[model samples]
Target: MREALIVWGGWPGHEPEQCAAIVAGMLRDEGFQVHLDNSTRAFASPQLSTMSLVVPIFTMSKIEKDEVSNLSKAVREGTGLAGFHGGMGDAFRDAVEYQFMCGGQWVAHPGNIIDYRVTVTRPDDPVMQGIGDFDYHSEQYYMHVDPSNEVLATTTFSGEHAPWIKGVVMPVVWKRRHGQGRVFYSSLGHVAKEFDVPQMRTILRRGMVWAARE
Candidate 1:
């Protein structure tokens, strides 16, 4: 059976523990043997490379250099990496190398907890197939994204929230590669309750599966 490791912890504001539970349930339903951990130190395990996927639900925390090194090496050698919102996008701010692997960093959420729409850019992609542009109610993330990311969904910023970026179209979901591993990230899910939204949940589920080593 494919194994997946989920390490969740950090700022409680993001509900990392709750979100991790939801994700763990999702993976179990998909036939993966899931391991749930509450500390970033889990990344330091020598067995990390044996897992098929690594889901980091950690946000705004410091990761030890050895732990980060091991985690990055495991992914580079083919373990998959996938996450959503600040869990993955806002994690380990001091580790630039980790940020480089994630492909984007959460810089701001203008007009926090507001209504917005997500537009599918690559509906034909497996990760986006059958999904349509949907209205979302949460923090609309403004990120510093890697240009190489294969953007799957996007959102347009109206001047009402942040005037300077009004006409800007920001990537809401994207997939990329870190060495031999598949990396996926979504800038949605400010809190666990947001998972009640079908579009939000579905996109995340599919993204995680897609990021798993095949």
Candidate 2:
């Protein structure tokens, strides 16, 4: 069976454990042998290289150098990396290498917890297949994303919160390649319950599976 490791821990505000549980259940249903933990030590395990996917649910936390190296190497060697919201995007802010692997970093969320629309930019992509534009009420993430990302969905700023970025179109969901590994991310879930949204949940599920090694 393909293996997946979900390491979650950081700001309690993001409900890392709860979010991890939800995703873990989904991964299990998808036929992956999932391992769940709340420490970054899992990143350094010899088995990381053998795993199919790594989901880091840490937010605004510090990761050791060795842990980063191990994780980066595994992903580069074909282990997939996938995550959502601040868990992956805002994690390890000081670790530039980790951010490079992720292809984006959470810079801000204007109007913290507000209503917004997520527009599907790539309807034909398998990860977004069957999904349409949806409405959501949460932190509309204003991220600093890598230009190389293959953006699949986007959200337009209304300028209600940040005037300077009024017409900014930010990527809400994206997939990219880091070495031979597949990297997928979405800035949709601010908390566990946000995944309750059918479209949000479905997109994440498909994205995770798509990121995993074949």
Candidate 3:
């Protein structure tokens, strides 16, 4: 069975624990030997090097240099890393190395929680296969993404909330490589309940599977 690690905790408002539980359940259902941790120290575990995938649900938290280094090394050596929303995107804001590995960083969410549409940009990609443009009522993330990322889904700002960003297309889902590892991220799922949306749930599930190293 593939091994996976879920390290959660940072911002309680994002419900990191709850969101991690939902993803953990999905990973288990997919035959992963899921290990759950409530601390970032888990990233330093020897087992992490052997993990097929690592899901970091830590948002707006600080990570020690060694801890971040260990995680980076593991992913660089082919341990896949997958996460979503501010948990991964906005995590360790001061750690450029961490952000570099993620391929993007959450910059702002205009209009906070608002109605928006997610467009499927690469429907042919396996990570987005069977998914279609869907309606979402959540924070429309405006991220600073790497140009090299392969964006699979996007959203356009309506300018209703933020005038200057009106009509700006932002990536909603993307996959990239960090060294030999696969990295996948989605600017969705502000909370665990958001996964109840079929499209969000499916994309997250498939993305995790795709990011897992063989």
The CA lDDT at 188 in model 2 is: 87
- After superposition, candidate 2 runs with Cα above 4 Å error: none
Q: Which stretches of candidate 3 lie over 4 Å from their true place?
A: none
Tens digits of lDDT, candidate 2, 11-130: 999999999999999999999999998998888888999999999999998999999999999999999999999999999999999999999999999889999999999999999988
RMSD of each: 0.7, 0.6, 0.7
- Compute each candidate's TM-score over C-alphas: 0.98, 0.99, 0.98
Model 2: per-residue Cα lDDT at residue 26 = 98
Error in Å for residue 183 of model 1 = 0.3
Reference-based TM-score, model 2: 0.99
Question: Backbone clashes per model, in order?
Answer: 0, 0, 0
Shift in Å, residue 112, candidate 2:
0.3
